[model samples]
Structure formats: structure tokens, C-alpha cells
Target chain A: MILRPQLQDIKIIGQYSGRVILGLGLLMLIPLLVAVCLGEHAAALDFVIAASFCLSAGYVLILICFTHKEPTWKHGMVIVSLSWLLAMFFGAVPLYLSRHWGGYLDACFDAMSGFATTGLTLVQDLDHLSFAHNMWRHLTMYIGGQGIMIVAITFLVRGAGSALPVYVGEARDEKVLPNVVQTARFIWLVSLVYLLVGTLALSVTAFSSGVPAVKSFFHGLWVAMAAWDTGGFAPQSQNILYYHNFTFELITISLMLLGSLNFRLHYALWAGKRKEIFRNIETVSFFISIMLLFGLTAFGLASAGSYPGVSSLFRKGFYQVISAHTGTGYMTIHPLQFVGEWRALSLMGVILCMAMGAGACSTAGGIKILRIGVIFRALLEDIKRTMLPRSAVVMDKIHHIKDIVLGEKLLRQVALITLAYIFLYLLGTLAGIALGYPLKLALFESVSAGANVGLSCGITRPSMPAALKITYIFQMWAGRLEFVSVFALLGTIIALVRGK
Target chain B: MIGKNFVKIWLVFLGISTEIMMTVFIMLCALGISWLISGGWR
Candidate 1:
């Protein structure tokens, strides 16, 4: 018996949900083949289970919930948010059930790390991992960065209204093109271009560093995805320091900024809007924050004598600054250095940078700078109104896509949400501190997790207390979707419990 | 017409990003040059 969900409720799951899940399942097939090729019986078996689960799950969902109704904006958010949650949940299976990893929590942590493009890992010895496994890990970041939903939209059978929420939930709601599918297409193309250029450069650097061709090729692909997504997963057990070359660091830095940028800027460029580079407020803020934070951090680190010379001073400080600011989470230096010395001032700069996060639609996660800009513009409006007489009235406004959006109510809503972000941060930190971790370490871990920055001061380990792990997981979820979608989920739950 | 506008805007933005890319290129060259002058990596 087919139970037709209400048309409204069906669209709430997003358009073509089954096809998208099938695609995710199909993506697993390649890794399954690779595992089979390597003759890793256990790994192949794991993929077989995962793929079957995804296929059947996708098939059932499609068969049961086939609806002609189009997705509205509200449905788009619900479906996209929940779809990611579902994908992450099912996606964790291969890692979770394998004989290699013991705990379910750790497996989910690893899978969420991959999907969220957060580089935090709980794996003890990455050296023992098979090549096929590492490649699968890299592929997860690649798919997650561009978004599997956006891929669904780009090839969507019904194109009219399907692109809006897919684009919006994929985090690129700002219309660079009139059609959202075109915007999504343009994003893929730009990413491909960067991937080609970035991989070649990184490959050359790695090869010159005496890394083998096979190692260079695989590592190059891994770094490209990680850096391009503002993700910090390193191919080596030691992360980026495995190469330990300044040139390698420089290459990764450039890629992180490129990945952190909104695709609209790229689209605008492809269309010959040279001024869009300067006109982009998010890009401007990203650079300004990097510079200001880098300057202060380098000075403080140098004064503290963390490194010997000025070049090395700029080198270490700038990389860490970008890693944190972009939420890429790669670290070349010991966290102990950042932790023990320059605690108050350095951490302040670092924390503020992580909170600012990356471009709106880009893979880098957190509250996002565009929303922050909206909040800032709102504050300025308040200040101006304070100085003006009672009779005077003001309109709040913000700039985007070469136009102004004027609405005080919208601005107030954004500001309120930003305040909510701060509260979430403090709450996570307190939870960790209350559980018996050092105060500073707890605060750092909370911000890192909450911002999805993925850089641990070495505090989060396999041995970390269970209560702390739970805290970090919630932070990662809240940070990745931003607080709005989580709040929306909470509201839905509340409504069901209270009313229905 | 919208597609045309989108193309024009993208190309113009691309041109500016080219300059930004060039700045990065030049800076990278400087790093290599100074490294060479300083007798290469330690």
C-alpha cells in the first residue's frame, strides 16, 4: 500500500531526493571497485554493505515519496538540511562497521569530518590505511565541498524551481546568474579549473621534495581537495608537516583562499566583471581579517621567540592564521607553542578569525562573513539613529550582487542569529570545561569544533573523555549548517511535540 | 540577455582575479629569488 505523504510534506524532502541518494550510492561503487582491485576483502565487503544500503534506501525513498509537487523555499531548507544529516548518517556505515575501527562514535566522527570538510581525525595510525581507503576519504571531501545536492540540481530532470533551494542549501543562495542551475554549473567549472592548476602545482612541489610519483599524484589530489575546500585533511599521518617544505605550505595557502571564496566572484570574473573582486564584501573582509590577524599574530609570536628569524616568523604565523581564519585547520607548528606561549593575545586573534569563517557558499564552514557584514551594517544603522532626533527615521540596508537590500527587519533577524552563534560557542566551551578539561584547552577545542575549523591544540585525542567528544560532535553539526538550520530543526521538533 | 549579462560580469571579474593571481605569482617569485640568494633551503 502506497502512503502518499501530503504534497506539502513530500516537497519538504527536496526535489528528486531518491535520485540524489542513488547518486551518493553510485559514488560508493567506485570505491568499492578500488577496494576489490586492491584485494582488501574486508574493505570491499564494507563497501558492498554501504552501497546496498544506499541503493535500497534511495530506491525505497523514491518509490514511496514520488511527488510531482515542486519544492518551496521552506521545503528546500528542510530537505537540504535533513538530507545532509541522512547522507552523513548512512555515509558513516563503511567506516563504522569495518574491523579496523572499534567504536561507532569514532567512525561517525571520521565520516562527519570528511563530509563537513572539517579535517579533525581520530585515527591513531594513518600510515597503516590502504591506498583505496585514503582515496575514498579524499573523494568524500571533494563531493561534500561542491555538495552532492548541487550536483543533483545541475543534472536535475525538472529544472524550473528545483535549483533554488539546492543552490541555497548547498550554501550559494546569492544569485550570480539568474538561473540557480547555471550558478551551480559555473561553480563546478571554476572548481575544476582550480583543481587542475592546484594539483599540478602541488604535484610538482611534492615530486621535487623527493616524493614518489604515485605518492605525489595521490597526495596532490588529497591536498587539492583539502585546501580547495578549506579542509585540513593531510595525506600523511602528520598532516601538512610530512612534507615540511615552505613552498608546499605556500601552495596550500593559495588553494585555501581560492576555495574559501564565493563562486559568484568566480562567475562574475568569468563574465568580465573585474570590479566584482573589490565589490565583494566577503572577499574584502576575508583579506582584511587575514592581514590584521597575521600582523598581530606574527608580532606576538616573534616577540615570544617561537621561531628564529623574520622570514620564518611570517611563514609560520601567516599559515596558521589562514588555516584558522579560513577554518582549513591545517597546522605546521606544534599546538603547544601556540598554547603555552601567547595565550591571551594570540588566542583572541585566532578565535575571532575562526568565528568569521569563510565565504557564504564556499565549503569553509561557520557563521559566514556575509551575515556578519549584515549585522555590522545593522549596528551602524543603530548608531546613526541614536545620534539623530526622535522624529528622524532610518532604513537599514546591505550591499550584495551589485545591488542594495534595504530592510531593517531582515537585518535585525540576521543580527539576532549572530548573537545566537556567540551563545552556542560559549555553551560548548563551558560544557567541556565543566567536564574536567583545562579551561584554555576546552575553549580552543569548542571554538575549533563550533567553527568547524578542525585544528585541535592536540587536546582532542582517542583518549579524550567521552563527554568532551559528544560536545565536539554537536559543535561540528551546528557550525557546519550555521545555527539557523539547527534552530529550524529544533523548532520542528518542538512543534511536533507541543502541537501535533 | 541574462546569460549575456552573466558572461560579461564573470569575464570582467576573471580579469581582475587575474591581476590578483599575478600579484601572488610575483610574490612567489620573490620568495624563490630570496631563497636562492640566501643560498637555498637550510
Candidate 2:
């Protein structure tokens, strides 16, 4: 039996949640600055109103729930989960005010998608959207990728013990540093460094591809944020295809891979542990899975005779496979190409890649390569145990930043999370099919949303069913939190409803 | 001191370069396999 949450529990959760919302309010200032610089006074005013509202709401929560008590683990988890929902509502304020969405629900969906780092969009006339709104959309991904709670922990939240639970609640279990604050700073450092490098690379490629210098810089920065965060919102509806350059695609591919690496691995690499890149189980698993999926997709495309030559196959076929696998959702081809042109087998291949996703503790979502690696290693260990004599002892180990023994507890955790991901994928798929979409397209879009992958096979549109939109939003939220925090939030709700 | 700083910078550059090369290498391996399966060499 669970005890009902006390008022103090609510206060603790509210205080932390308010702090995170305050951090988000601070983040909204980025787009406001962008609007001011671009001389979009109307858009700047929209941001001003939204920011003020967010700040005011956050302050009210903090003031009302003011507490001297530190947040417990349950409180941290509750805070993280509630903060995401609140962030979505508050984040949508500016988007809704922009009048680009059909309703507040649509704005909330896009805001959730952005904050979850899932690239699905419900905004109307995305091509005609304001620079400030577009910046906010992509900026949400960058913030969400590092985690909104992490920003709070880095700046506002004191007490290392209190910060750790919130940090872990955001689906980042790996502590890159001993202290949570230092880890948060390092995460930001890695992202900022990559942002500068990726922006420059993309800007040069964009300028060479005929975009004006100023526009190219902005586009490059936006695309860099989107790709590096694996958030699929592109400034233009055409996405990567808008630039029409292979060089630009190549740069984005690099950014996506780099972004999907675990922060611990990034720390290791930065510390000059070059061999760690090769020896890390997640890296090896990703390399193997990507290659196999690439082959599967290539064969499917070739069998269908979709692309005439190897060049087109690499450009069209390979790029989408990698993008899907990385959960970046930077599509060069039109969404219709997946449904009308690509065969079922290739579609399945892309779906499988999207479901597998990138490294653990990274921005990208899905089952994660680390869990995949652990599962495979566990299987091998089982096989070895069966073959070995009764007296023989088998100890399975995998290298991350350090060597970790693969115990049953670890395997159980991996299996549980992987199963939960598949269930989430199926839930979305069933919802899609119930809404009259075909099984293949339903599965593709479901896995895309559930995996936080932005790839759409022509199903996600402004005119799509509102039920499906809400379903994908839930999937993105649950997927990004990896079900743990979501379940915690659900438990809290249950306790409130039925607990004595 | 200048030489030491230069060496440090060079090491960081080398580390970054190796990582990039590894990324490209993996991408190429995938592309090459795809090419082979597509019968492009033939």
C-alpha cells in the first residue's frame, strides 16, 4: 500500500518544478533576442509576453510552494515529470500567440515535440513562420536535449544529493563527473563546442551551396541545433533537401553521430582516450547495427529498383537510413517517397533503425545502443553458460567509460526498458491503425514518434487527426523520459486518487 | 611554454581528427557494403 503524498511532498515537487520552469523562461529570452536583432518587433513583443507569463507563473508556483525542505527522490522524479508538462504548456504560449497553429492543442503538441526533442510538427505554414518562432522551436530541442532539469540543477538547484535525482530523472543515469553540477557544466560545454564547430561547417557548406552569407549562418545554426540535438524541426518544409547539397548532408550526418554519443564517451574522447571510441560497447553496437540496417535498406531499395545507381542509393537510401538510425529525422526525400516509392522492406528497415536509435545517455531516443549491447552480451553469456561445464563460472563484462560487470540486475533493467519501448511503439501503432492508417505506415510513424524519431511517411501533417497528434505527443514524452519518470508521475496521480 | 601550448593544441586536434576519421570510416563501411550488395562494382 502506498501512502498519500503529503502537502510537503507537493511543495517540494512544486518548488523544483517552478525552478525548472524559471530556467525555461530564461531560455525563451534567446528567441526574443533573435527577434530584436532581426527587427521583428511584433515577434519580439510576442516573446516578451510569453516570457513574462512564464516567469510570472513560475514565480507564483515558487512563492506558493516555498519550502526550506530539500526534495527527496520521489519529489525529484515528480518535479521532472510535472516540469515537462508545464514547460509544454508555457512553451506553447509564444507559439500559440504567433497564430501559426490551428489551436492551443496544436501549439502544445509542437511544444511537446520540441521539448522532447522529437521533430514532429503540427504548426501550419512552417515555411512562413517567423524567425523568432522557428528559433524557439529549435532552441527547445537544444534545451531539452541537455534537459530542462539539468539547466536548473546547473544554475539554480543547490545540494548535490538533490541535483542527482533530478538529473537521473531526466533519463540521464550516467554521471560523467562525480558531481552533478560539474557533469551538467560538461554536458553544456560539449554541446556548445560542437555547436560552434557544427554551425561553422554547415554555414560554409550552405554559403557554398548559394545561400546568402547572413541567411546561411542562421540556417546553419538552426540546422546544427536541430541535428545535433536530433530534433527534426527544419526551418523549411523541405528539411535538408532545401539546401540541395551533398556537403551539407555530410556535415549533418557527422553532427548527428556526434550528438548521439554518450556524454561519458565524449568526456573520454576529449580526455584523449581515443581507443575508447572503438572499444566502447555502445559504439561497437551502433557501428554493427547501422551497417546491418544499411545493408538491409540498401538491398530493399536495390530489389525495388528505387534508385537507379549506387550514387543515388548512397545519397537517398543510405542517408535516410542513417538519419533514422540516429533519430535525427533530417530527411532529404519527400515524406511521400517512403509510402509511394519505397517498398515495404525498405520501409521496415528504416523503422527498425529508428526503433534501435542511438547511444544511451545521449540526446537521441529509442531503445538505445547501450541497452542493445547489454542484451546481446547477456545472450552470449547465456549461451556460454549452457555450453560450459556445471562447475565453470562465466563472468560477462562490457566497456563503457569503464568496465562494468553484466549482472542479472543490469540485464533485467535493460530487458524491462527495451520491452517498455516496444510496448510504447506498439501503443502508438495501434492508435494510428485505429485512426484508419495502414499497418506499415502506422508502425513507421508510431516508431518514429515513440522513438523520438522525426521521420514521417506522410502521416504527420497539420491536418492529421487530433487523437493521433495527442498520442504522438504522449509517446514523445514517455519515450524521452524512458517510462521511469512517467511511471513515477502516474504513481503519484494514482496515490492522489486512490491511496490512503 | 609556447611550444608546450602548441603541443597541447596539436594533441587535441589530433584527437578530434581521429574521431572524425573513425566516424567517416564507419559511414564508408556502411556505404561500401551497400555498394557491394547493390552490385555497383560489377
lDDT of 2 at A343: 94
Docking class for candidate 2: medium
The DockQ of predicted model 2 stands at: 0.59
Q: Write the per-residue lDDT of candidate 1 for residues A72-179, one digit (tens) a residue.
A: 665666666676677677777777756444477776676667777877877666877766667667777777778767777777546847668656655555676788
Error of 2 at A28 (Å): 1.5
Mark the regions of model 2 whose C-alpha exceeds 4 Å error after superposition: B1-11
Q: After superposition, how far is residue A346 of candidate 1 from its true place, in Å?
A: 1.4
What is every candidate's C-alpha DockQ against the true complex, given to 2 decimals? Answer: 0.21, 0.59
lDDT scores for all predictions?
Answer: 0.72, 0.89
Question: How many clashing pairs per prediction, in order?
Answer: 23, 0
TM-score of each: 0.87, 0.97
Q: What is the TM-score of chain B alone in each candidate?
A: 0.80, 0.80
| Residue pairs with backbone atoms closer than 3 Å in model 2 (clashes) | none
